[model samples]
Target: MRANLCSLTFLLALTLQITYTTSKHLAERPSFLNPCDYNGANFDKCFADNFQLLFSHWHDGVPGLKSLGSLDPLSIKRIKIQQDSGATLNIVAELENMLAYNASKAIVKKATLDKSNFEVDATLELPALYAEGNYKVKGTVLGLNINGAGKCNLEAARIRLNFHLATKLRDEGDLTFSDIVSLKAKILEIGDFHIDVQNLFGGQRDLEATANDLFNQNWRELFGILSPTLEQTLELVLKDRFTKIYAYVPATYFISNMPRASEFYG
Candidate 1:
């Protein structure tokens, strides 16, 4: 059970890593992604709309962003998650052809960029994402011990995310520049979650059916215990992802039309 739990954690981390990893050099922003003008009267609204558009094309590789064209139906080597030394739950699983969906439907509540101090804040609400994959999972889930294999699907619903990005000032010879320094992300709310893993107890058809029922019936309680750790993992994963992206893509591409740092400081 411990082994399986570790494997699930590893696989989940791998899945998230692959989803956001990007590296390429584009001298300018892609035309499809229209940049927002900070000087505009409706800068916040413009920025929010632009942010939503980015997610709409998230899974698909935008030529201007990265060339890693496809990011769906990923083959997971292994996955494991253990809670409290397996006292609560332990799951070690493997998934083939995994795909995560519904990011395009995300809604941006508000987004603001404060150039004076080089800070960015955004609030977003995601209704749900259905993740489906062919899986083999073993351990305790919903207070039942079971061995399961076959198709599995899960849904995480009513999640809200808040993000803040900070920048640092850099002095290079005669020119001063603002560089992305850090990112903080938080999960504000999670209303519900559903997990379905088929074929539990290995070859026992009746037990399998009953286990699935229990999973559906007791998801809320299970999720409540799991949400805290999940949120921390998500925040760390997202911070790493955006930081890497900013590393590869120059700041000029993001705010080229805005007033120059020279003009503001001079």
Candidate 2:
């Protein structure tokens, strides 16, 4: 009798263990459908709308900018701009001074959007771009410190970004819904960031003359070397803004409809 009782107790415990494990596993399973499917919501419009709404909030800096972290006073310990063979100049630069770039307005000139691709032609009016830095040059160029500050402007800047829809289940209390898993935005064109820096050599005639020769005579060389840093700075600014937006907005908000899939996928 005791043996039969022990056997029955073991069987009951095993049954409970199996039931608990299965239930937990099922509960953890995601409930949303793949976002890229034909049956899923119209992601093209979703992306377009989000982008438009995003621009509206750009005046104050990307929505939720504070949460992402500071993009201001971007640090550039040192950056080198190289030239191609037979190029007139090569330069190494440093921003000992901090840069303050404030965009007063942002307008999307044009945009192409779909489930798989995205692109935009936009302009950001940076009413203020203060520069405090120095540039040292080598290779067919004047070697000296260029120190100054002035107005910076970026006009008709074009950006091309492509990404696919990703979905994940977000649990809030007793409710759960799909959310954007992750995304990446690539800047095809950093556009033109021109700095009208003064005092190339603190009014030193010889150095200033060489600087003029390098810049005026070999403008392409100067642009080639300087453009990368400008591009990277712009990229960081844009990425931070988008990241903040992504955190507050749900994936479904960008889509026209949500379709349920038997299996969950990105």
Candidate 3:
């Protein structure tokens, strides 16, 4: 009788062990048995990958600005970008005193990035010029930002931008010049800016000569002499005061294929 009782006890213990092991295995497995488990880790991974793919294509697929028609000489090119990954970028393209008459070209000279965000440094090259009114360099941003939270699966954040120009003095004379000249006032938003010309020609002969040449329709000659100076000035100003002039402008349009969700899991 005692032997039979011992056999029964062993059977009970084995049954309990099997039950415990099965329960633990189920717990370790993914809790995605139901369709409502869309909020699981698998979903997060899928969403993140899709977002990155979309952004990469947008950045590299868009045609360069050169495809666009002639840009105005008085305007500077500006680019701003934001990402859902908490990254922000800003880029400015300066004409570098390129002549309006020449077939000017702008290129991305250098790019800096912090993990996910990137900023491009650009320079404009123009043929020699003898005349100058106001020259412009065109800049644009071709990127997208996506933010997901709560019930909304995606949101485009804001990006702000502000641009300024400064010219070096060329002659030794007190000449009043305006830096913040408004060209197409309506084209830019409320905060666009221009150079502040206050007695710019007080003590520079070369600058004065170049300015005169620019105004006299000798744009080709002016470009050769002034382009270097303009490039230097732009580098200095951007390094010293870019943060102050920086603005956060929002994305203009959405470029994502992801479906908008009414709610997200944390």
Best by TM-score: 1
Off by over 4 Å in 3: 1-71, 75-104, 109-118, 123-130, 133-229, 235-266
Judging by lDDT, tell me the better candidate of 1 and 3: 1
Model 3: per-residue lDDT, tens digit, 45-89?
333333232223322222222212232221223211111111111
Backbone clashes for every candidate come to 9, 0, 40
**lDDT, candidates in the order shown:** 0.62, 0.38, 0.22
RMSD in Å for candidate 2, one decimal?
19.6
lDDT of each residue in 146-262, candidate 1, tens digit only: 776788888889989888889654444333344668777777887777777776676687887788778777766556555555665555545654554555444544443665556
Off by over 4 Å in 1: 1-24, 32-34, 64-79, 85-97, 134-137, 167-181, 248-250, 256-266
Question: Which 10 successive residues of model 3 have the least lDDT summed?
Answer: 7-16
- What's the CA RMSD for each of the models? 5.6, 19.6, 32.4
lDDT of 2 by residue, 143-237 (tens): 43355322222222332333333434454433334444444333344333333334555556676556555555544445445444455554544
TM-score against truth, every candidate: 0.71, 0.49, 0.19
